[model samples]
Structure formats: structure tokens, C-alpha cells
Target: MRALALASLLFFSAPPPAAAVAPPRDAYPDVARAYWVELDGKPLWAGQPDKRLPMASLAKLMTALLIAENADLAAKVTISRGAQQETGSRLGLRSGDTARAGDLLTATLVRSANDACRALADWRGGDQPRFVAMMNARAAKLGLRNTHFADACGHDAPTQYSSVRDLALLARAAMKQRAIVDAARLPSFRFRSGAGREYRMNNTNALIGRYEGARGLKTGYTPGAGRCLIALADREGHEVLAVLLHAPERWWDSIGLLELAFDEAKRRSRR
Candidate 1:
């Protein structure tokens, strides 16, 4: 009984475990100027998140979001001459081509097809400018304070701009839509041209198949925008959204940023 009492006293008198120290934020190398936000049960690391920059193809996220919100995916749309003539990262769709809204959306999101995006906008909003207005409206509704849309296909325009933080919000909102998520996550997809030619389209978001836990997002580049990426990844019940703007090497920067985010999340989870 004396021994037991002594042991109990010792246990009660023992010091508590040492408090955990957080990893320093500077541990991650400066790969690019970036803005990261964790949402829907995730974490964020941001830099100059509100600085507006040309979005390039990442603007398609907004286009996809608008299409998913306003149009039935199964609806058919006739490809216009204007849509066919759009340049940059296209599937070579021709004028007078017709395809289902779902297929066009798949092309737009997975392949970053400029022609497909323009077709979707024309079909949904009756014209490119009107569609851009809708995109701006959607941005307003989403509370994206630093975003503006000048074109539907992310073609270079003086007014087309978005910040990393704003794009993160857009990506998060788009992920909530099943169709958008499905289209974004595909490694590769097929779209039937207006002329019934089969075109195999691959995702521009290189991280989808290359990185563990990577799902969907977008990539962009222009002489003005540099290289940009909005990347999403899921791991161990945690989701992270990372955005890089004007990155000299987008793929390398994105991978580095994601690695940092995952490490930070894990470190916090153990605390």
C-alpha cells in the first residue's frame, strides 16, 4: 500500500509534456510570389495574393464555373466561326461544328481549349462580350474583389486580370460543382469536333497525374503573365489550394509550394 501510494504521488507530480514548436514559415524556399488559402477543411500560404495579374488559361476556371452554373451540360451548341478562329491551346475545332455542352466543357477545362471556351460562352451568353459580363457578374457574386474578366477564353486583353487570392476563391467555388470538378480532374479526355473528328485532349494542369494527391486546377502563360498555376491537392483528409503568379518556372514553383503546404498542414495536424 505504501509503494502504491508513492507511485501515485509520483505520477501526479510528473511534469506535462513539452509544448510543440511550429515550423518556421521561412523553411519553404522562395520559389515564386504566391498566395495560398485553405478552405473546405484545408490550409493556405499567401504572398501578394491581392496583386492583380493576367490569368492566361486559368481564366477558364471562371468560364467553366459559369457554364456549369448556367447551362445544361447535355445541351448541344453549334460552333460559330468566331469560336473556331480563336487562337492558343485549341483542339482545332472548325466553324459550324456542333458538340454537346458537356463535351465542350471537358475540352475547355482539361485541355484549356480556347475555341471550346469561346463556343461555350457564345452558346451560354449569346456572344463573347455578354459572356464576359456574366463572368464578371459571377465574380462579383463570389465576392472576388480583385478580379475582372475581359474575355471568355483567357485571351490577352488589357482589362482581363485576377489576383491569386481571387483565383483561389474561384477555384474553391468551382470545385463544389460536380461537372467542373470532373472535367478538371481528368488526365486526358476526348472531344468530338464539329466535323465529327475525334480529338484526344490532355489536361494542361500537369500535376494531375504527376503528383500524389493532386486533383485538378489550371495553368497559364503569356508574355505578360509569365507562368501561373492554380493547383489543388488532397492528402490524408486535408485539402490545399495553392496559387502562383508570374512564376518564372511554374511547374517547379507549384510543386515546391505544394510541398510546403503539405508539410505545414501535417505539422499543424500533430499539434
Candidate 2:
């Protein structure tokens, strides 16, 4: 009984266990309102990925994808009066102007040109509403329950919204088309309209030609959508795709996330 009493006293006097040290911060901190990172087809990290939010001009990805899948690249698309009046990030196309379907797709994806996007939509669906219906239908087919589109060029709208997760899916589907992959990676695109006018535009994605291994993808911004991006990179046969929505510092955050994702992948491989 005396020995038991002594042991209990020692147990009570022993130093308490040290409090667990938390990491400096979350794996990602304030990266975005919604973000998702994937490496080699596996999820690496995500934050509020399924929360539907304004996508801005990233909606052009679906427009470009649908064009790649259904429209003949060589076909001519006549710019309508409505397409000419499209606001924000325009390719300066005028009414009665014509451009190749593929060129319009390139301008749409690379420059986030709303005029080019609306022209493509008009050519494909005969009207914006019809094209939006097709976009929603494609979203449904892809199982993107959290996505919907009220505009072809991603103007701020109450009904147009998509999640980071859904954007990732949409980006992947769009990248599968060679034309999209080609256009998105270009640093600049130049095309001519039927009115003998030339349109030269730089890619909206800043990473192109700057970040090593950075490839085709998309970027967007609007008053409501803030900054959005679908960034893709390939290194040593490994692919990393990241989606960011409403990120105040999308370029820096995207670079940081891609670096962290690749580092994490390397660590996993070592294990």
C-alpha cells in the first residue's frame, strides 16, 4: 500500500505532455475563396472547392471546348451586331466581320475576348440563350452539379456560377482538345477579320512564357468574380492542374500552390 501511494504521487507530479505544435498555418492560407489542386490525376489539396461562385471569363473555356468539339475550325463565323457590342476584353470585331472558327476560339481562350466568345456562341447556337442552354447541358453531362451558366462570356449574373471543383473538371475536359491546348499555351494570338482588320492580343494568363513548364489553361476577372484561374503545368511527365476562384492575388497564389503541390508529390514519391 505504501509503494502504491508513492507511485501515485510520482504520477501526479510528472510533467504534463507538451501541447501539440500546430503547423505555422494551413497547407494553404487565404489562397482563394475556392481552390483545388491536383497532381497526376490525384487530389493534393482543396479549400471550399464545391462552393459555387462567379467564374468571370473562365466561362470561355466551355465555349472554346464546345467549339473545338462541334465546329469545323476552317468554317467562317460572321460577327453579329450583338457580338460587336460585347463589353470587356474584346478583340475589336465589328458587325459584318468574319473570322475562322478556330481563330475565334483562340482569341476567346487566350485573350478572354468577350466579343470573340459571343461570336463563337452565336455561330454555334444561333443565339446566346441557346448557347447557354448547351453549356448547362454540357455541365449536366459532366456531372458538375454545382455549375450553371447564364452568359457565354461570363458577365456577372445572379444565375451564372461555378465551383472550383467544377472548373477543374471543365478545364480538364477543355484541355483534351488539341486546339484548346494549343491556343491556351500561346503567349499571343493574331487573326484577321473579314473587314481587312487585324487583331493581335496577348494571352490573359500571365504564367505563359513566364512560369517554366506552364502550359495551356485560362484566366478571368470581373467586378464580382474578382480573379480566377485554371493553371496547368507539366514537368518530367507529371501534370499539375490548379483552379482558383475569387483570389485577390491569383498569380502569386497559383505559383505558390503549384510549387507546394509539386513538392508534396515529390515527398509522397519518396515515401
Candidate 3:
């Protein structure tokens, strides 16, 4: 009888294995190569967040910030040969097409248009080389030591890369601009060029309208970068931001991180 009681006590009192419970922050360990989670501007959890990696279209977030801070949004930008001819995602602007800085800004944030991003950079930096230099300079000022931009728009490059930690800072700065948040959150936009051509753009971020409490941010993917996301959410006044890098399951992982981050924040506050 005493042996039976001792066995029962040992079985009941022993702690459960770590895997028997959900991962901390519900981290998508299989896909999330590196990530950073923050609630109310306090670090909640992370995984190798300082590891520099290709950011892909996430580069546009920084471009949008610099333009928003340094240039006049209403200024007219005459589409240069380079802006119209750039490869990858584009607004389909012609070499002679004209647009305001604000319009290109919106397109870059919403649709991840490579052309729109280049146009904004060209207009503000006067040329790509100059613009890239400006991007680096801005990074220095922002104290993003792990960030470097090869282009205004995220294109896979040997020198272009950013860490999850560095990108969260960039996103935080970008979010301060109401226009950027509006553009990111916009469900869809129909932009008519000065050439009288209509171009319809849609948000590439899966979380924009589908995820409850989600706010404006960005998404990125490339063969080299895999899938990346900078996501923001506000749940009952507990605002959370998450940066996931090289995630094969970016949308799902990001949603999980955001949801869990908020849950953790609430749990702590209640304690």
C-alpha cells in the first residue's frame, strides 16, 4: 500500500515535459528562422533576432519612411527610365508617366510595387546610387547597425540585408506616419496615372483585413530571403509588433506570434 501511494505521488508531482505544452509565444519553430515580438514597446520574446538576413520587399518600409520625413509628398515625380524599367513587381508606370510622391508611396506600401518604390527613391535621391547612399545614411542615423539597403525597393542583393530586431525599429518609425499606416491598411486602391491609365493595386499582406486587430505593415519574399513579414496588431489597447524572417509559413507564423504575444501581455498584466 505504501509503495502504491509513493508511485502515485511521483507520477502526479512530476513536471510535464516541455514539448507537452505549447511553445513559448507559440513560436513557429519549424519555419520562423528568426523573430522578434514586442508588446507596448517592451520586448516579450525573440529567436536570434539580430541575425542579419535579406529583407526582400521589407526594404520599401525604410524607403517610405525616408521619403515621408525628408520630401514633400505632393511633389510631382516624372517617371524616369530607371523607375519604369525596373524588374519585378511594378505599378506598370510608363517611362513618361507622372505621379505625386504620395501616390507612389501608397503603391509601394500597399502593393509592394518595385517601380513605385524606385520612383519615390529617384524623386527623393535624384538617382539610384545617390538614393542607396541616402538609405545607408538614414540607417546610420536610425542606429540600425545591422541594416543596409542595396536598393530603395527590396531586391535580393549581396549587400542588402536587415535583422528582425533592426526591422522592428524601422517599422516602429514607419508606423508613426499616419499615411503609411493608412496605405498599409487600405484594402485596395485604384491608382490612375497622370497618363490617364488606370492601375488597380491590392494589399499583398494577408493580415491587412483578414486578421482581427491587425494593423498596417509589410510582407516580403524572394528565393534567397524565403518569406518575411513585419506585422502590427492592437488588441484591446495592447499593441504588439512582430518581425518574422525566412518563414516558410510566414502568414500563419506571424498570426500565431501576434496572437500569442497579446495573450502573454494580458496574462502578465493580470498578474
Q: Which prediction has the highest TM-score against the true structure?
A: 2
Of 1 and 3, which scores higher on TM-score? 3
> What's the CA error at residue 96 for candidate 1, in Å?
0.9
Which prediction has the highest lDDT against the true structure?
2
User: What overall lDDT goes with each candidate model?
Assistant: 0.77, 0.85, 0.81
lDDT of 2 by residue, 106-187 (tens): 9998889999999999989999999999999999999998999999999999999999888989988997899999999999
CA deviation > 4 Å runs, candidate 2: 1-26
- Tens digit of lDDT per residue, candidate 3, span 191-234? 67788888898899989889998877998888888888999899
Where's the lowest-lDDT run of ten residues in candidate 2? Answer: 15-24
Candidate 2 at 172: error in angstroms? 1.2
**Model 2, residue 201: what's the lDDT?**
90
Tens digits of lDDT, candidate 1, 1-271: 2334433432333222212321112222244555554533343445676778888888999999988887988988999788988987888887787899999999988888899999999889899989899999999999999899998988778899998778888988998899988888899999675567898977888899999988888888777777888888888877778777777656765665566556656666777
Off by more than 4 A, model 3: 1-28
